[model samples]
Target: MIKQILPSEVVAVDVREDPPEATLFPEEEALVAAAVEKRRREFRTVRHCARLALAELDVPPSPLLRGERGAPIWPAGIVGSMTHCAGYRAAAVGRSEVVSTIGIDAEPHDRLPDGVLDAVSLPAERVRHAALAGADATVHWDRILFSAKESVYKAWFPLTGRWLGFEDADITIDAEAGAFQARLLVPGDTAEGLYLTGFAGRWLVQDGVVTTAIAVLR
Candidate 1:
């Protein structure tokens, strides 16, 4: 399902269950050693998916560690993102020469928790969400908006090494096209010399999950 939203340059792998064979490297285990069972399982399985995606690019498996802001430290020359939610875990990776950055997220297909919509969205976005919900009551636009912002931040941080607040970007959802665009409100240049302005991403709602992805090419 995650592969459906990402570009061909990216390699995506997803699984609905934790593979019993999935085991975290010692370093990774120590990172989650104090966490609850659920946290440990998700952490382990998500990395499992990440390694599979990396292997698709002929990259050898390595201990996927966390860096600034807890983002996964990918192998050199690789850009990737990982996300997990109830019953879903996925990872997407790409060669840095072909892809500059990648961000992906997944969430259960449900309404945002009370007050979460307002906290994570601009007023204009809320207005648009109302319009979308009024038109089609089947999809959860608020949750998708939150997930898109997450993807935007994930893609943004690796390039700029900065924190992007929920209000930092204005998201517009194109319900019919299964896509969204994020206009960055902050001003900065990416490390690669590109003026960081906005991002275009794709979203999908399927089989009780909502997934969003952004991949910026070099």
Candidate 2:
């Protein structure tokens, strides 16, 4: 499920399983044992990714547990984030020393559902974003917005010990650079208000799948 994209400084991974394979943890099995087939399959996908990561670090293949609010926490000093969807799964790891905030997201290369854009973006955001990224933009605006929010959650939770909503961060895609710049509207008391220094985003569309990464500045 993981393909190392960034060097050791930033680790990125991707998975290709409907509903993903790394969602299950040992503790969740009992609760979900009687769940429908679809849910069980999804859990298997997520746990596979998590277990592979633990094994690589020589840890047991037990389920990767989540703390309050579903934040994944591994034993000992490792810091990372887990992301899985209907089509893929991924995890980003940075040895506790250098990595500050890391986030990865995968979205299908499809059009936004009706009214979905309005729910995610305000009128001004929609206008400013298009101006910020004129023509020749290959990436879709809604996907960029959704991916940016996911990354923010992954990167911010560990640093701040707090939760942020989707409206907390905003993004402007830079087509020329093949990336996007994100601005943090509200970092909250976590990390002493981690204002947006900047976000280095990398986007890829492979075999009709769209995956993007937003590694928070150190």
Tally clashes: model 2: 12
For candidate 1, write residues 1-218 as lDDT tens digits. 99999989999999999999999899999999999999999999999999999998999989999998899999999999999999999999999999999999999999998999989999999999999999999999999999999999999999999999999999999999999999999985988787988999999999999999999987
Residue 208 error for model 1, in Å? 0.6
Give the poorly placed runs of model 1, Cα more than 4 Å off. Answer: none
Q: Each prediction's Cα lDDT score?
A: 0.96, 0.63
Compared to the true structure, candidate 1 yields what TM-score? 0.99
Which window of ten consecutive residues has the lowest lDDT sum in model 1?
188-197
Model 2 stretches with alpha carbons more than 4 Å out:
1-5, 11-13, 18-25, 128-138, 187-198, 216-218
Q: In TM-score terms, which candidate is top?
A: 1
Put down candidate 2 lDDT per residue, 22-134, tens digits, no spaces. Answer: 45656868656898987776566656665666556665665566687877766565677776656676776665666666677767766679887777775666886577446
Q: Backbone clashes per model, in order?
A: 0, 12
